[model samples]
Target: NSFGSCSRGCTTIDKLHWWGASIGNAGCEELSTQLVSASKPYDGKPARMVKNLLLGGNMVGDACMGALARAAAKGALKDVGALGLSRNSIGDAGVKALAEALAADVLHPGDLYISGNRFGSTGALALASALSESAAMRRLERLSLADNRIGDEGAVTLADCFATGGARQLESLHLHNNNIGDEGVVAIAQVLSRTAMASMTTTADTKKSEKGIFRTTFETIGTLERLFLCTEGAAEKPQEDLPPAELLPPLYCLRTLNVGSNRASTRAKGALAGMAAQRSVECSV
Candidate 1:
């Protein structure tokens, strides 16, 4: 199972694009060894040439994941940007290993796509904790946990993580098609409300900076997110499966709110107007 033979043809000594090299049959031992070996070309300099590591559609089991995590601990894949582990059989154990790597600032991927792997609430919680504990996680922008077995509990944990630190720079998040309920939506709304203020303040600071003000206090977005409270692709048939508008708060602030879905649009619109009535500032709902 040594990918040694394919390693030569698969990797171009300088760059490697073996998207599905070993795939399902490739275990952790070979890959970890491969990664560690990849970091050996330079005697004193860094041998991190692989920027994107796409090892999806395989069953890189938990034991192998531990090995991969160890390899990462040694700065084997330090320069990896994207790590794709979709369609694999990675469960909570495997996810925990990866999370540990992230928590320790060992594996730093700009984008992590772990969709379709059979990881559930535990895995989600582990990942949330990892992201929360690591400041290095701010480099990560996109995260996808769709089609997993994550329920309200995991969703809430993720929301709390978002509300806290380590997720300020996160932009796009995919958590649809899971067992998330109204509680989860409320948690998401809460995150949006909490995160919006700091985001807006950061933008204000950026404007001040542009105006030649020497004030360095708060961190801001490279691409600041504007507050937009509106729903998209409105549902017409009154989908009962969706969360209730009543569960949301009066203000229901958002960075990008989209609540025009279902038969309750008029009621929500009125509610939004009522909430905005007392406010002196001008902010669209």
Candidate 2:
């Protein structure tokens, strides 16, 4: 069967593993064309079922990467849930294209790996913007960008991203082996600290506004203490005083943050540890 044809089990492909294939730009462009064509739904059947696309170490460059990003942005890869593009030759232009696609809600990937690339602060800044501003990126659980050239500027901007209330559901962030410095790490810690405090205050205020939640009370008998569970109007709808949870920025959900092998100093590490202690974050400095 021809490439991109829905025949011959092509429609059942759930993952595209092309890592270290040495497929140059032209080759990748060809494969991308086929995949994009195959991704369209036909005859009441689901589109190409690819949820994971790995193209690491393929000598992929800006041209093909741009093409793929454009295709994905146009909704050709709507079902993709993970993307791995580590150890490529992609530069800032390519990375920016991918960032644009993500910002445009091309695919709702839970995990994105772009480590060991040839991008720098510019690309990282674009990615940070997308992560912070895009509603679709809220589902992102894990992101890895290790072994790149993103420096202090990128790191500080990432901190700003969190301050602007982004990546609420992010569970892990891998930024090891980058060029981040002490100031960058400190900035990140401070912003995270502030965000955590805000989250705590929001939680407290929400609890205070809950007027009719069921609560257990204690009553002292002559010989023993008895527990009494009561609810005044728990079954009723919440009062107008109940705040809109969505309107408030959610607590940062990061469980692990890897910033090791960078340029941070001991003082920065101490600050990071303090922030982690306050927010219960696991940090690798």
User: Candidate 1 residues 1-285, lDDT tens each?
Assistant: 111233322555434445554544345577678879878756777665566666666566577678878988888877776676766778899899999999998887766878777788899999999998886765565677766777778777887776665444444466655666666655655555444343333332322344455432234321222232123211121323222322222222322223222122344434433433432223232
lDDT (0 to 1) per candidate: 0.58, 0.70
* Candidate 1 segments whose C-alpha is farther than 4 A from its true place: 1-22, 42-48, 197-215, 219-285
lDDT of 2: 0.70
Runs in model 2 deviating more than 4 A are 1-12, 42-45, 199-251
lDDT of 2 at 1: 9
**lDDT winner:** 2
Model 2 is weakest, by summed lDDT over 10 consecutive residues, at 221-230
Residue-pair clashes per candidate, as listed? 4, 0
Give the Cα-based TM-score of candidate 1 against the true structure. Answer: 0.67
Report the error of model 1 at residue 34, Å: 1.6
